[model samples]
Target chain A: EAGVVQSPRYKIIEKKQPVAFWCNPISGHNTLYWYRQNLGQGPELLIRYENEEAVDDSQLPKDRFSAERLKGVDSTLKIQPAELGDSAVYLCASSQETGWGRGELFFGEGSRLTVL
Target chain B: GESVGLHLPTLSVQEGDNSIINCAYSNSASDYFIWYKQESGKGPQFIIDIRSNMDKRQGQRVTVLLNKTVKHLSLQIAATQPGDSAVYFCAETKSSNTGKLIFGQGTTLQVKP
Candidate 1:
């Protein structure tokens, strides 16, 4: 069927403005992840959710970044008062792994944010 | 469109030739390793994966060779085509919190037609 879907394919905002990105994962996928990819760098994990519980979020910047995957299907990542350094592609991915298994991750086109 | 591997290492190959891209992972205890292909302005697509217990895995037209002794991984593309040109990434994953998937910087594959 359809793959993961993300909203606002591209966003541009001035520094210190608030920005938000949304994601809808594949159907029947139980795990979701949020990652940030900087220019010329690989995507880094920001938060991971299994169902509705956040299993990993150590990489997320709590001071300015926050994420929630309510209902275990769609997720939203928010950055308040965005900084110049916060400009990056926010990617959302989903997997079908259970328990301690690591399955293939299906990713979306990503929300590209540019902060000036 | 924005390119993904601006400062990353590159591998240039001719059409219909064999191509090999290598990566050195960080964790030796990682449960498994995976390969992803990402094109310009697109998300990464899964290519193949190999578990720690396995040294090799083959896909449609690709092969993944894992050398755990040196914590190295390689992806071999047979009869490489221009469509195969993209950024390749290798990631290591663990089951625990400390084992989040660590993605490599990615290698740009330039296939000359």
Candidate 2:
């Protein structure tokens, strides 16, 4: 039973460049989430997906950030024209279901992005 | 390495000592809470969780205490070890969001070797 897996453990890009991060959640998990963790701060929810549909994305920067979970099992987060302030760890987490007592989110080693 | 906030409230404990970390949540509707341990460069790992129904829950060597009255939560680690040192975060989830947890400001635990 492997945990969530993310690709390109680390990434670096310049300002105005586009960057993308990928995530693969745990098996049989029906819910997936993408979070942005800034230095010295806690992880903030960027978006959440239940199966292939995005249920929550209010926190995501719609003008520059976009995400998709085409098949529902894997997800990708993209930031176009990345800004210097966009540097942060992009984390992905998954859970068994939605409801009480099922709120434990299993997280993957995040993808760290550095924008110069 | 994640830069420590200008002045992180630190909790230093001697090896083998018992440690307690506290958190305050804002949302009253949040019915679920979780404790996560995040090592350097790694994602937050679940340490333990407690539902709003129960005031306290215990795991192998860890315990989570929740106080709905004060909207406070605490994580207790028995026989703390150096490996247990990391940034700990407490998150709350509303019963409606299914399980989207709103995380706290995080606390950094420093275990004195």
Candidate 3:
């Protein structure tokens, strides 16, 4: 039983460049989440997907940030024309639909984005 | 969402001693609470959880205390070790299936050997 996998572990780009992250959830998990953790701060939810349907994305910056879970097992988060403020760790997590939003989550190491 | 600063409150304790990390949440409607441990260069991992109906829940060597009246939460680590050094976060969510969690400013736990 492998845990959630994300790549690449790190990325460095200049401001206004485009960046993308990929995530693979654990087997049989029906819910996936993307969270952003700024320096020294707790993670904040960016979007949540339930079997390919995005149930919550109010916190995502629609203008520059977009996400998709096409097949329901893997997910991608994209930032177009990224800003300096976008530098942070992009974390992907997954849980059981049975727990819905109330269960334990397994997380990946996360993709660290550094925008200069 | 709660405002977070770059500097987090830190708790230091000696190894083999008890450790208590406290968090104050603002949402009274939040019924589900969770504690997460995050090490450097890693995402958060769940430690323990408590619902509004319950006040205490214990795990292998950890305990979570929920005070619904004041919207407060605490995680207690018994016989702390150096491996327990990490940033601890407390998250709350309103009752639903969205899994939208509001996280507080994390507390850094430094266990001294």
DockQ of candidate 2 compared with the true complex: 0.66
Q: How do the residues A1-116 of candidate 3 rate in per-residue lDDT, one tens digit apiece?
A: 99999999999999999999999999999889999989988889999998989988999999999999998899999999999999999999999853435657888999999999
After superposition, the stretches of candidate 1 with alpha carbons farther than 4 Å from their true spots are: A98-102, B1-8, B95-99
Model 3 residue-pair collision total: 0
> For residue B24, what is the lDDT in candidate 3?
88
Model 1 is docked with a DockQ of 0.50
lDDT of candidate 2 over A6-106, digit per residue (tens): 98799999999999999999999989999999998999999999999999998999999999999889999999989999999999999998764466788
Q: Count clashing residue pairs per candidate.
A: 0, 0, 0
Note the residue pairs that clash in candidate 1. none
Residue A67 in model 1: lDDT: 93
In candidate 3 the C-alpha lDDT for residue B41 amounts to 80
Candidate 1 structure quality by residue, lDDT tens digits, A10-95: 99999999999999999999889999999878999999998999988999999999999888899999999899999999999998
lDDT of 1 by residue, B1-113 (tens): 11222233888888999888888888777868889999998889989988888999999999999988878888989999999999999888865432268899998899999
- The docking category that best describes candidate 3 is medium
State in Å the error of residue B82, model 2: 1.3
**Candidate 3 Cα outliers beyond 4 Å, as residue runs:** A98-101, B1-8
Q: Model 2 residue B42 lDDT? A: 89
Q: Model 1, residue A5: what's the lDDT?
A: 96
Tens digit per residue, CA lDDT, model 3, B1-113: 11133324888889999988888888888888889999988889988888888999999899998888777788889999999999999988865743778888898899888
